[model samples]
Target: MTEVGNRHPHGTPCWVSLLARGVEATQEFYGRLFGWEFHPGPSSLGTYVRASLNGKNVAGIGELPRDRPLPIAWTTYFAADDADKTAELVRGCGGTVGVGPLDADDAGRLAIALDPLGAVFGIWQAVHHRGIETSGEPGSPVWNELVTRETSMVATFYSLVFGFETQHVVSTDFDYLTLQLDGRPVGGIHGVGRGLPRDRGAHWMAYFEVADTDAAARQVVQLGGSVLRAPRDSAYGRVATVTDPEGAVFTVIRTEPLPA
Candidate 1:
């Protein structure tokens, strides 16, 4: 397990959040799936709670905004030194800021935005809350990736906006690039070409760590959620795609255990 301290470097995938339709039900679904515990969060964003694992914050869940009515999905947040400046950079880089660089009740400054290819992501200038506190272990976030049709274009967008350094992943058939900060990979972009989902479009995907991929996928179904993709072994781990009861999609992976 990895424990995160306050102040992540800019461009890191620092936090993730799910805005679902039902607050209590969403909490129960995730809590049961990942063994998470919930605690209250800033009220300015409506009913929200921080999900914790063994006393460390791992993610957040908020009730869907009544006025906005967006599709239930997980949003990956990148850390920023200055949210206002980052929002301007997003606008300057052919992206659109759909939400705020405004304060989230002193927890942080946040903004939701779309990339040139319409992939949704978030920027956070943390205050008292310093994003996720633990990761790289079962029940915590392990990766965040963007699936898009224009990998090169979106890579340039994020590189310019977030100061992320891009390295093309060498593959025969896959168009993939890893976004790096200080030579460490923070996230990735996968070029799906015309294979992008029509209804979903381009979006960020968050993957959580699990102890067992097949068991987690089964539990997702048992908890009223569904598995979009069956568990499969990959170079990184055994992984499965799943959705919550309210249709929020995420992946679960059981990577080879960390070395002692």
Candidate 2:
């Protein structure tokens, strides 16, 4: 969460959205999985809905452009005070701005871009909407991470673009950097080198909090989705990677221990 009423600071992971092949079908899948309620969003971006959990906005789902035919994937958006300025920074830093720094009515200004490594992400300048209303709670986003080939190089790109300070999380052999804004951890970057998914390239991954990781993974399969990775414990929590019916990948994690 970006403190509800308060605007998120620049460089923080402010929102995550999925542009799927079918809007209603995507809504049905996510609603059943995360118990999210859908509400109409800015129509300027085509069929779009904001997903809310218990009345607080958590994410967005929009219909993919028929003409462009983009991949069915979730994109993590970072907060920007000025969307156009951010787009300039992206281009100056060797990234590509594939979409607009244009207004989506009164909601906000946005631009979709790709990092130098071709990792897709977004920049959001909020107006009426303040990004996610709740986070770190069940059914809400808990973390966002960039998985790419080299953390050092891409870390510098984000640092220059977002003024992010990178904090190394692991040894040189295992490359990981926790992105910080104002000395607080906002997101992370992981370098997997040759292990990068050839089809996906570099991309930001969104993690949603769930009450039970194993149960959630099973529920995903039950709801016509697939578990890409089985539930497993990690340093942060028990997590599993899963994809929606349309193959948009995301992770669900049990951030707290279950009752005995």
Candidate 3:
């Protein structure tokens, strides 16, 4: 298991949070689905709840602001050394800053932005909280992926903003790019294929590691969620896509165990 203590390097997918209509129900759904435990954040932070695995922070959940009701979805946050500078880079690269380089109490400075292709994401400069405390284990985030029609344009935009080394995978079925930080794969970019609905547009999706993809998918259904894609074996492992009761989508994968 990878236990992260220090701040993540720039461009790494450091954190993710779900903005839902009902915080309590969201908490219970994930807790029952992934064996996660939730701890409420400071009251001043509204209804934010940190989801943990084995006592380590894995993700966060909060109610959608009443004034600015957004579609229930998980937002992927990439690490940045300077939130303001990253926001500026986003704008300069034809992206739009949707939120702020605003302070989140003493936790960090954060800003939400849209990529040129319209995928919304967050940038975080950590202070008191250093993003997810544990990763690459069941119940923790394992990967973040961007799906877009503008594969080359999106690739160039992220590479310019985050200094990521893009590695394109050769495949006739689909176009895929791996974003690397210091030569280590951190995230991926997938070209939206014809098989997907045209109205789907561009978006960032988070994937969580699971011990059993079929079992997790079943739990999701039992907890009022729906499985968009049934569990299927892939080159990577067994994978499934599911949506919470509020319709926030995420992927789960049962990866092959590493050689001892």
Candidate 4:
């Protein structure tokens, strides 16, 4: 198990959460699908619930405010040293701050923003709550990627804001770029393709590791969720895109097992 106790490096994807209207159903669905244990956050946090795997924090789920309804979706958060300063950088880089440079009590400071290409994400400056404690393992987050139509423009925007160095991965069929933070791969940007709805524009997608993609996808259906994309084999792994009962989308992958 990878136990992450300290804050992630700046620009790394530190956290992810689902904001949904059906909070109870969402919790039950994910809890059964991923074997996650849910714990309610401080009452000051409203309806926030932290999801853990084997006693280590993995992700979160929160009630979507009725006054400002949003489509149920998972929001990926990047680590920042100062969310207020990062919000300034986001604006300077042609993005717009949508919410906060606000504090979550003693947990952290955060801001939500829209990238130049319209992808919404968050920046978190950790305090008492460091981000995810277990990653790259079964039932933990393994990757995060932005799928956008304006690939080059979004690439430029994030690079300028987060000091990301792009490592272009040559592919005959896809335009893909890996975002590297201090020489380590943190996330990726993928060009939207013919298969996806162009009207959907750009969005960040999170992926969690699983032992079997097909089995997990089946469980998602059994638990009242929907499979957006059926499981398929890829160079990296077998993957499937799915949405919770409340419609928050994410991916699950079953990669080749690590060497013993």
Q: Give the per-residue lDDT of model 2 (tens digit) for 1-260.
A: 13224889988899999999888988888898899999999989889999999899999999888899689999999999899999999999999999998888888899999999999999999988889989878889989999999898899999999999989975858889999988898899999999999889899999999998999999999989998899999988899999999999999998765457
For candidate 2, the C-alpha RMSD (Å) to the true structure equals 3.0
| Best model per lDDT | 2
- Residue-level lDDT of model 1, residues 84-176, one tens digit each, is 999999999999999998888878889999999888899998888889888888999999999999688889999999998899978889999
Per-residue alpha-carbon lDDT of model 4 for 35-99, expressed as tens digits? 99999864665899999999999998888889995767899999997889999999998899999
Per-candidate TM vs. native? 0.96, 0.95, 0.94, 0.94
Residue 222 displacement in candidate 1 (angstroms):
0.3
Encode model 3's per-residue lDDT on 150-191: one tens digit a residue. Answer: 478889999999999999988887789999988898999998
Which model, 1 or 2, shows the larger lDDT?
2
Question: Which pairs clash inside model 2?
Answer: none
* lDDT (CA) per prediction: 0.91, 0.92, 0.88, 0.87
Error of 3 at 187 (Å): 0.5
Local distance difference test, candidate 1: 0.91
Name the lDDT value of residue 208 in candidate 4. Answer: 97
Candidate scoring better on lDDT of 1 and 3? 1
